[model samples]
Target chain A: MSALLTDDSIVDLHPLHIGTEEDGAVEVGRADTGMFVALPPEGVALLRLLADHLPMAEVRRRFGDSYGEPPDLDDFVAGLHECGFIRAVDGVPWPEGDDERGATEADPAASPAGGTTMRGIALLGGLGPERLRWLLSRPLLLVFAGVWLAVPALMLADPSLAPRPSDALLYHRVLPNALLVAVIAWTLVMLHEFAHALAARARGCTGRFSVGRRLVFLVGQTELSDVRTIARRQRYAPYLAGMTWDLIVVLGCLCCELAAVGGQLPRTVTYTVALTFIYQFSVFMRTDIYYVIVNALRLGDLMGDTRRLLANAVRGLRHSEPAYDLSGVPEREMRIIRWYCVYYLLGSSTVIAGSLLLSVPALVRMLRIAADGMASGPAAAGFWDGAGFVALVAFQFGTLGYVGFRDHRRTRAGTAATAV
Target chain B: MKIQIRKLERIETTVACACGS
Candidate 1:
């Protein structure tokens, strides 16, 4: 056991914001790690006292006065200490020892990209002006509402405007057009991510812009560090902001296509924009829509919980050791999990079907075309195109494999740590 | 008693509590 609490021991509690007092519970979030702990009222009171930098003896005395008994001060403190919620101020050894195995240290820059590449860019480090805040509020929100309503109405009126899988493949045939569309698409995605950052900034939260890969897809992420501290209404703004920009681009493309004299450029733009808009609806990946759903539903660890549930079910069928035991899950969340399981199946199937029908075919065609060009002659254009296409495919798949490998290794390390 | 501490590390939602909390 660690040393007992003394009257003079100084402690430094991690910076956190307490959630609204509701139902005899409070949500505490550490700002640095973005970790939330739902505590009973008594726990909140104890933590508040500790946060004031009071000695352990004072905290326990006050806690006893409030709760009618000298609560197990040592046990509670040990729990908090284990969770990295509190630290000794005078460099005293923690009761749990220096084994930082279980505590989650909040390091925002941690990426699967192996630390060599740039992870993210901090766009807004601090709160901005009143005007910027207002933009993220009523007027812009109303504008987004209009866009949301207008998009479906427009698509309904002009069914032809909806991009088809075949249109995406058109880029694969025309190399120059494909290159142009790729650059434009990349720029638009970055802008979409930037909009998220702007929304976060408007809410007086720091927004970080980052480019990373999730599986095979390249992603731009906006990290709103203080999002949990804000109201749910404010939280939805950043989540929806990226999709709002995507919709705008789609609308702009449609308008351009309607006004064009006669060329592939306008149609290409429309195709790319529409495809990008559709991509945002990919719920399997942590897309903008995924966040919107998560925030709206108030689900905590939905994916992880659902995954564990599935694993446990499979293990039970096979009569093997269960990977997860979920008896402790709240009934309400379990109900939600059931619904999420259905959606997960549907979403995953759609992605698989789409990839098989579209992406796989496109890749095979590109490979064949590259091979033919190389075998034909020393044709400079053909050689360059073939090399470029090969390099692009190699890089994409290589990064995906590398990231997957890293994640698997990290997961093993974490499991080992837990075992110890 | 061995309490399983669930770590909620995702950006969307998280909750920290002991096994029986």
Candidate 2:
């Protein structure tokens, strides 16, 4: 006896399943449903016979010749389609078309265009819809209001609330305290991830959770959700979600700082929150600002273009004309993207050079401070004092350096690829 | 008749958004 199955059963079966390994690896498995399903005694044999590389007519004839009556060929093929054992190629009509044997090769969603759609959707899911909608609607307005109220109020109340070495040295003065700030930032980032997950789930998609370094900053994120079928406009919200929340958090922090100042609360509470907000906004590296610019300009497609441009540039250096063609891109968009590449390329270089020029003094100062502390006493230069200071300095300069290097490499590659 | 022909031509030529080459 064979297991019973139906067309609906085959249709409902997931295209793929990922299994976990004992050693923390993932293995993807293909489910053989529909026509390939186990059936009563001779039926499995019959299906297997048809699965051979013989033509449809020949298979049907052979089945009929052996079994007296032929199985319904259309139904069998439809079952195969539902099971995903086979699929139509070129959107060609049913029956006589060739069935490409490999599972990966016959994928219904194989095109690069479809992959881009999926990636776009997944990025939006990561952004979260409600928060993203808020950003798109008017995040800058809220940010401005908070800045206007807080900056003036705080400055008036505390004349010394500036980004100076005195403030940096007076670390004990800033609070709700470091722990409280940590808790708040962590909560906000988690909320950002939740917004993404909820949006993805709403779209009938699923994803996995992960924690890793998003550029230089550590971030917790959900896996990219399948967005192939999602509409473009519907997607913009999810992409902007995290940044939206970040804006709100910044505003809330500013408001708290304002309250603390106006109501005569602890000075440390006001300063700490304000500083955190500023630190979040400081564009020394890619953050919310990166997403805003990337989406606004629709430069997701530029990764390939950058490579092509670099290749062309390299080719042009070798020969007169580019070996590869770049005529497919729209003239206006291409012009704008190229200009963006040039500006970003130039801007990053300036930042690195400027940073190096400025950082030497800071680095020397930090080293000198560490040296002085060590000379004075063990209490003055504690175990982690120098290491921590050095690490922080490295992190600050390293971030800018990394971005500069990546941008330059892309430009060089693009220029070389397309002789840009 | 002209409008019907135009519609037919569009039906034949109009590509699905997902079908980008």
Candidate 3:
């Protein structure tokens, strides 16, 4: 919102990289930093005029002649500077700290090496990305489709083979059952993320895998920010790659289950994989499928936009004033968001309610079991078993809280720093 | 008359865009 520049302000515009046209706006930004902004066609035309280093008044006059109205030159230019879209203002490089979003992504303190704490490890054995790129090749599409379709076909033939919650409980001891399934689940999670990384690498984009929280669940996420630079058609594999990997894993588990070997291991694997796979369909949590929906629909910042639209509605009700502008949201996007809002509430509520209600009975049962084991002393057969399960529960919730706090605090610090 | 410059997306910082497991 700063308007420090005058009519004579000599702005040296940065070299811009123009990206694909999404809906009506073109994605444009500095390639070096990977910071991009969506600008209307008219806005891009104005930017072209500014890049020519036109005089401030002349720039405004030209835009007025074309559009029938002149924009507020000072405010518009200042806004660009605030977004780090301007290289320099008045012959001095604009200080880049205004872009808090960029800081959150690229800041080493917030995200290690551009959104990855474990850099290059996800690429498999220090091998080149080319080695894994073929996993996402178009020719393999038929294989993947067959593998995914096998599950429903098999399930229909034998109803007992469908993945269920009971299948996850494989052993009498809680620790053994939890450990075996957790190991497999986490392994598949990493591979699921690797699929996304490999898909992006195929298209000459490099992203990293990291552990992050999504609502109540501790999730494994891939930071495929670079995918935005690619064509929309090429973007799908990267976005849907994780789900593709999950389907393969599920197919393997089903085949193993039908083999009748591995005792209960295959069933546990099926349960764990199936539950997580179904969770991805919960698009409200921004799962793998959500990105495809967003990309395919060209719904840029759908969640954030909907939240603001909702806030504006509430604010208008309370104070007869809106917090955000309503004019910018295209009616089509607004309609989609309206349906998204209903789904968001239902999905989010289900997670929260399940966390509260279902956990109570589960925790109570665990506590009772722990109490019985503790009364028998340390040397008893089941004493440490209950203790171990309780500890596992504690560890899961503890890590969830700790990571959530760390992420929240880091974002708040970035915003606060940028505000100054 | 006034012109509008929409600031729909300042920067696309997709934190945890795709999550699984």
Highest DockQ: give the candidate number. 3
Per-residue lDDT of model 1, residues A1-420, tens digit only? 337566676577667788775434456765554456556677777778878888777877888887777656667667666555665654555443221222222221223222112224566555564647877767778988998888778778988766664554434454444455566666766777777777777777655564444434555566554577787667888777777776777677677766764355555555666665555666655566766777687665566677677777778899998766676455677998888878876876776676688778977886888877667667667766776666766755675566556444544443112210
**Candidate 1 chain A lowest-lDDT run of ten:** A108-117
Considering DockQ, where higher is better, how would the candidates rank from best to worst? Answer: 3, 1, 2
Candidate 2 Cα misplacement greater than 4 A, ranges:
A1-229, A261-300, A320-332, A375-384, A390-420, B1-21
lDDT of candidate 2 over A41-151, digit per residue (tens): 234434445445455566567777877787675565554443344433223333311111111232221211111111111223344445533433456546645654655
**What is the Cα-based lDDT of residue A137 in candidate 1?**
63
Predictions ranked by TM-score, top down? 3, 1, 2
Query: Model 2 residue A151 lDDT?
Result: 56
* lDDT of predicted model 1: 0.59
In candidate 1, position A9 carries an lDDT of 68
Best by TM-score: 3
Query: Could you tell me the lDDT of residue A287 within candidate 3?
Result: 74
Q: What local lDDT score does residue A101 receive in model 2, on the 0 to 100 scale?
A: 15
**Model 3 chain A worst lDDT window (10 residues):** A112-121
Cα-based lDDT at residue A128, candidate 1 = 60
Q: Which docking category, incorrect, acceptable, medium or high, applies to candidate 2? A: incorrect
Q: Could you report the DockQ of all the candidates, in the order they appear?
A: 0.06, 0.02, 0.19
Question: Which stretches of candidate 3 lie above 4 Å from their native place?
Answer: A1-16, A30-35, A51-70, A100-133, A316-320, A414-420, B1-21
